[model samples]
Target: MAMSSTCAQLCLRCRGFLGSKTSTRLHYIQSHHWRIWTANSKSLSNGLFTNGSFTSTQTRQRLKQHMCYYNNLTVKYLTTEAKENKNADDTVRSTDGANLPQMPNTTALSIPENMNSLDLDAFNEPSALEEISDEEAVTIPFPTIPPSSTSLRDYVGKSETLTNLVQLGVDLWKLEQRPNVGSMLLRLDFSTDVAPRLLFLKNIGVEDSRLGYIISHNPFILTEELENLQTRVNYLVSKKFSTETVASMVSKAPYLLNFDVKRLDNRLGFYQHQLKLSASNTRNIIARLPRLLCGSLEPVKENLKVYEIELGFKLNEIQHMVIAVPKMLTAKKQKLTRIFDFLHNTMKVPHHLITKFPQVFNTNLLRLKERHLFLEYLGKAQYDPTLPNFISLDRLVSLPDETFCTEMALATLEDLYLFQKTL
Candidate 1:
């Protein structure tokens, strides 16, 4: 009875101490104290200890173990609670009204049942990518001029000429299907001064489609003074170009009319005198390559230097080469050097033969190698120009595959086919 009273007093004291802690700690203390008391009672009832008194050291060891376990659990619980509280604080702070920006509500509005049934796929169907017409396409707006600007004013005395130019522009646009012809004419700042020159161009056989091409390409031709256009024409005629040729040149290259007469004369003189080409040859060259007259003479001069210094060609030989293949003068210096080296060193062809057949240099290097190697393999690679069996470089490279195989190589088609595969 006394021991029971003492146990009750100890339990009361434990409860009193635990009451000051959290509910979880109070519950743990009550459970642990009850377990210790029951164990002590069982030890007492079994007489496990010799003495009537409990061992204070054993009781203190058990208390220390329980305290250590409870302390670890309390520490774990406090850590979990601290983490949860921190998360809650962070969430609250992040959503604070002062820190957050106001966002618009973007909830979708409900669609009607009928609208839901519509085929939305029809809107995404592939459509033809038709070109936009000039009327539909956007263009830079024309510059606005004052109402009293000359472009807006009608020539009071030359109403007929104004009507003629407008009619001409409209008809020409219709024929060529050119857009913004009216706008372009306004931008050219057309006036009565350009009327007689247009008439003169028409009188000189530049009419209809030809005239349209000229005016469309060079609208300023209409603004050119009459004397300038006439002098250009007269200069061409003085060079013995027929009236037809002069008209054709002008229609093809209207800017030819804009070139200074002295500059044109200098270019022509270079072709005839420096290149040693006859007047007829010079005309033919100009007709064949109209751009030659348009470009500067520097390229021609540079090409001559390449021929003399690089290829070791005499002046007469260079003239012959240019006359035969005028484009060779325009060929890159590196390309010319490669071809010359291959011909002189690799093929062992004489320099005279190379100059005689300058077109050989223009032939593709791979094709040249294939043909020469195949012929060499057949022991028919004739290098001498005097030999009866000699193959001219032109005839060798220019011939069709079958003709070259049968006539030059004298091999069957199958043999040539197999040889080509090897190459």
Candidate 2:
């Protein structure tokens, strides 16, 4: 304990007041062979205290209180420089000039990975951090020097922050959407930025499982102002969405709050007005497909033309179909056209019938054709209610093969299966 404490005091006094951790590290790295640093987490504050940079006990105490996160942080300093004296005694002189076992010299040196402000030319000479004695050897009781390793924890200084993020199911790499993640983690104050955001997310009712997806995809959430975020959430609630519903929207579309509220309001208005939908219908559409706000309006507008002009659906029918299945608006242009052609041309379905069962088009083309062919073979492909044994377009596409055959087709599952196989 005494030797380690002595080493800590010596390192703090010799190296601590050199500005940021980056400059301090560069100074040591250039003379890495001579400087064996302390691993104490609290060494920086201690260094400032000893060097008279922080003179007042109250000022020092406040600094300590603010930067106390360094407490209990064990930092490993690794340096490698090829040894010149292989036959030299395995010893270094301690701060008190005691003989200590020398740290092994090697071929490569590593700057602390999280040090963000490195000036490689910070130290042109080794006198800044003087070696007390080069000829004598000393040893101090210190934690076993860890074997060489690179870890997420090395870059992310505080283990608890990482633990909480991992616990929340966040992928550390996903947080790299922001540049310089290692530096950010080292400098990020958890109390001010990270914790409050996490708590705010929870208080807003984002689910635990969804937390990972939301945060990993949108790391800016950690840095966004709490008041601004609250305003966005409030704006959503003001639009008649419940707090719980807003959480669902935010989780699914993590960037939803990233949009301006006026733009958001304009978007909501666009969807409602463009579709000629009721305000309630527009809200329902957003509830069902939160990503609706994120996509470009061009494709949506184009498809509206496609439905009314090319597909020959009346404007009113288009609105009704979109309300029934809002995703229909976002459906692939070619596939939607193909499905509409098949329903209107091949199956002789009326425009109103297609509107009545908009979800029928949601099924793939092959399934629709295969089932229709199978029904045709069985002589049961009737759609008119007045005709005998009518088959709804929905039941045709929706039911499992066996259920479709037994209930709708009045044929065996084997028949349907065999027909499908032939196709």
Cα lDDT listed for each candidate: 0.65, 0.71
Q: For each candidate, give its TM-score against the true structure.
A: 0.49, 0.61
- What's the lDDT for residue 276 in model 1? 82
Model 1 poorest 10 in a row by lDDT: 102-111
Runs with alpha carbons beyond 4 Å of true place in candidate 2: 1-160, 172-189
What is candidate 1's local distance difference test score? 0.65
lDDT of 1 at 197: 64
Return the top candidate by TM-score: 2
Candidate 2 residue-wise lDDT, 48-73, digit = tens: 43433455566556445422222212
Instruction: Name the runs in model 1 displaced over 4 angstroms.
Output: 1-227, 247-255, 277-280, 412-414
Q: For candidate 1, lDDT tens digit of each residue in 232-324?
A: 778888999887777667767767777778978888888888788889988976765555666777877887898888778888888777778
